[model samples]
Target: MEWSVTDLAERDLYKLLVNTVLPRPIALVTTVNAQGHANAAPFSFFNVFSHAPPLVVLGIEGRDLGDAPLKDTMRNIRATGSFVVNLVDRALVDAMQVCAIDFPGDVDEIAAAGLETAPGRKVAAPRLAASPVQLECRETVSLSLGTRHRNLVVGEIQYIHIRDGAVDERLHVDIDKLDLVGRLHGADWYVTMRDRFQAPRQTLDTWRAQQGALRAKPEGEAP
Candidate 1:
């Protein structure tokens, strides 16, 4: 039921990976071109990597198939070395989809999506005003991989803006208030955070005690 990666076609591999990944966070990234023209794009191939230096990673693909031009977001990032990651919540999903359209380079996706922006505190890229969370990031490094114009970008977060009432004085965030949405299987599917469960982490002592209790139980009886 398994096949080697080398044997699979690129599109097939992409389908398998995306369909099985299950609930990936979406990043509605915003960046400004060299002329200061703003651009907004949605990328599900994104995630926060580290908190020590506050780093995030993004997987960006080239325009069209082969060695065409780079996407607007990638091009802007390369030109300015700065961008903003706007976490997509349920309320922002529709606008995020509007930003995903493959419009011409001259088009302003943000305005097309009917979204407003605010000036970034640390980066030149403007932040999506409606996004529950915005992270201002400076590119640390970018690696070009394969012949298909695939790129992996690593950015260090310079500043973060969280929506009011979402975080408390102790910095504890209210998940219900955040109401973030995640990319699900297939092209048009998505998931919400409302359906969730909790499983507390176990220590070695706790595990040992549980095992001992199980052993002391009568045969075929529940502990």
Candidate 2:
């Protein structure tokens, strides 16, 4: 079966993408309003795009639920040029959900979620005290797309904060200890990193060794 994107509705296209994307990391972003009120929201459309500049990219939808209502986080970043990306661990999953609610502009999502906050070293946006890992990022660039004009926020990570027990002397993170969770298909669906597997990458020489006799030799040169 085949489907043309143009023939499909936007909602259907979005559903198709989400359902097939597997699990995505959650970013519980925190920003500050002009009045210094702390705002927190969870966005699954987020990931680290680069390490050279230490960039984190977040795909922010239009402001409102039905129409572009102008999200507080977007406005705050546009106004202040900085925000914090907090990792969602098992302990903070419920609080992250509370922050995802579509609250009024005046409502402080962080406060409403009953999460504690601490000032960031490199940005005005605060950090979620419950989060095991947090990134203080400064807006470096933004791109707009989609008919509703969604914003792609690309920010440079200025500083990273990790819980004392999460990392080791060599700066290796004990991922399991971090207890991070990821977003699934539906509103309440999620996955833990506890279950994982590993596969070693292969090089050409290794590949040739594995297929010794199977490899083709010069025509009639040798058996």
Q: Give the root-mean-square deviation of each candidate in angstroms.
A: 1.1, 4.0
Candidate 2 residues lying further than 4 Å off, grouped into runs, are 64-68, 213-223
lDDT of 1 at 36: 96
Clashes of each: 0, 2
lDDT of 1 by residue, 134-178 (tens): 999999999999886778999999999999999999999998988
TM-score per model over all chains: 0.97, 0.91
Q: Which stretches of candidate 1 lie over 4 Å from their true place?
A: 65-68
Backbone clashes counted, model 1: 0
Clashing pairs in 2: 63-70, 64-69
C-alpha root-mean-square deviation, candidate 1: 1.1
